[model samples]
Target: MSEATGWPFWVMVVAFIAIGMGTSCMYLGAVATCAKNYGKGKHKGIMLAVPIAAFGLSGMWQSQLGTYVLYERKVDGSRGDVDVFRYFLFLGILLFVIGVIGTFALRIVDDEEEEYIDRTVEDLERSGLLEESEFFRPRHEIQAAYGTFNADAEEGSVTLSEEERQQRKRDLEREEEERRKKNWLLNYETRIFLQDPTMWWLAAGFFLVTGPGESFINNLGTVIPTLTPRSYAAAAPPAGLPSTHVTTIALTSTIARLLTGTLSDFFAPVETHLFPPIPEDRRRARLEAEQANRPTLSRMVFLLPSALILSCGYLLLSTPLPLIDPPLLHLTTALVGFGYGGAFSLTPIIISVVWGTENFATNWGIVAMMPALGAALWGVIYSTAYQRAVNSGSGFADGQCHGWSCYGLWAVTSTISVWIAVGVWLAAWRGWKKRGIVV
Candidate 1:
């Protein structure tokens, strides 16, 4: 297509990129808002999981709709006729409608902010559950309020001497005055988030897990039809195994998202809950002191299983034997789907956990691009390998590619790459553990 249009194809490319960016922004914005509203409450993982799960399930709905609605059967036994451009138009209109409706419906209530501040400290003292002095606020806010809350200090900065307290108040007022004149988007929280290494670690982990899954998703249509003998391809349904694989993936991925996110919340870090014997105020002080320096782990330990599951699936395809059978392909796709969902859902919640929710929208958006980077890299590998295989033999005819030999090496390489990604995440996990962090 690009060769035919030359420079003009760049217009289509740019438009597609713009569309992708727009959709991503909407998604991250919704997720961050939802996560922030629920982050301080119980079951935060499950609360944040629903939006991402919907994202996973949307692909299945789109696949089924496009298969039946966009393509018409020919008079002959084989299916041929398609109105792809019209189908895309329909999709665009549908998306626009959804976006409009969602914009109105997805409300993040701001009315409770004053109430939250008023009740938070009192409630913590009453219930003995508050972790830090500024557990609900951004770290920058905490710092600005009373300097660092040192555990061993004479009064830990919370009960500063009258003169010291007055100085701190003035400092906070000065900081607030400066903040009022600045853009909220480029605020201190965002600057702090950019400097954190844990964010990069999580994003890299996202890239590693999703890259091969994306490669599988993108190549499945080509892989499935071609894997079968040429005789079978002519008789297969227009929306046969490929569509089934994709839908199955989405379904499983959605399930994974819901289950994993909910489970993570149930397994909240011990530090978050109230411990007895110690006075409520003292416990709160200790909790705050601990939280001040450490990044919150978003129960990302839940994803270790997902990484292993995906690795197993990739291993199956990497084997020398042809995965020509539909049942086996469906099973593999389902596993991949689960991992895909887990990665997407968990990463956002993790970002919300580790990084303060003050700049979650921007932080999630920054990390979300890692999967795309992975996809682009793996896509190149799959494309090059498949093309080489096709060129080496008598080329494909009638939309049918012949043989498994083409994909075997690519599959193995992808499997190795995925395992390496798993290792990277494990390293991150170890680092967290070494720093006395819990996931």
Candidate 2:
């Protein structure tokens, strides 16, 4: 249910624009509010805005596409899932726009001769800077080279005498010393942990499991007993019932984002409240100790637990609920959808946790490409197989129409997904082993 899953092209165009406008407005409004109250640079304004923008894009597109799918399926009985073009297009547009906007936005406050002033920020007197800055606000690209804006040191426009410079040099070195000690865990905090090999294997396993769960889990409606000419066991969902298939994934992911968003917001405050008065260093140490209990590597832990929930949900959906029109089949797909959303939301960022940010797009793109391909190819293989076997009378479920065709399709798709996952994990593991990141 990404724009990548494609709905109607015309409808999607409209959805994209509307979502973009709404998302931009909401983001800008919040940023404006933050600037008015707490100020933007230090208020996490950029970080907060980007994700919200992402939500609008995905949410609107998914809704539009889902509606179109429902309409199409009802009109012609097809789920008409499209390629991953929307994902790529939206992503490219997002990054390009952000990068461009950032470039220009920065130019609005541009300064060229300020190199002299800028130099005061990064250097400690020990590192041979001319003097310590009286203004302790940060100056270098606001965010630690890894993030967005950081407060710039605004050195008052004043010249210093030789004696003032020397004394300030001493002061700067002392300031640098205290700064380092104050946030000793800054590096560790900014960086994600990836010490264990087993965790990567777990991540790959999750990826493998999701391949099937994503593409064909809700698909049983179009499949399974559909193997028979019109197996009446599960009444064909009323005309437009199957249409939900179009937006099911998108809707599911949207819900997951909402849930994750709520939890993430809640936890931040809770953590801050619990350690309201703890010394910064001690709090850092304590947090590290807690995370040690559940290795950051095991972030896949969420996926593992969710996967089982999804499987059960899918199973239930497979069993028709008497009152439900499409049966629980469509609704239960939510479990799988949530898991996929969680994985989709987390995986790329998680990969960067170990691989570093040097080429994050390349690293994540490759991971994403494989699954996208797997889902797509597996889908066509499944669709075509069932069609052929049903026609030949040797397809699926003991030749009860074409059951085996679906099995054959799963067999091949699963095999391919497993191989892709294994290859990625092994390569990552070997790289880490040789690099000796563990030490």
Can you give the TM-score per candidate against the true fold? 0.75, 0.44
- Residue 384 in candidate 2, Cα distance off native in Å: 5.8
Best by TM-score: 1
User: lDDT (CA) for every model shown?
Assistant: 0.69, 0.45
Lowest lDDT sum, 10 consecutive residues, model 2, at: 268-277
Off by more than 4 A, model 2: 1-203, 217-240, 261-298, 313-326, 394-439
What lDDT tens digits, residue by residue, belong to model 2 across residues 165-284?
556655655565445433432232122233345345645655575666646643554543543334344334331234354356557766664554333322321121110123456556
Per-residue lDDT over 1-439 for candidate 1, one digit per residue giving the tens place of the 0 to 100 score: 4546445878889979888987886787678778768876667788889988887788898887777778766778555544677777887898889889878877767755444433433553565444442234565675555444333343656667868866766676556634542333235456657775655676787888888888889888777765566555444733246767889989999999999898787765633321112345755676687567554444756787787788777777766444446446666777788877887787777676665454577778888778788889988887777778777883476634456666777678777776777777777766656645455
lDDT, candidate 2, equals 0.45
On a 0 to 100 scale, what is the lDDT of residue 402 in model 1?
Answer: 58
Stretches off by above 4 angstroms in model 1 are 1-8, 73-82, 112-186, 235-240, 270-298, 324-326, 398-400
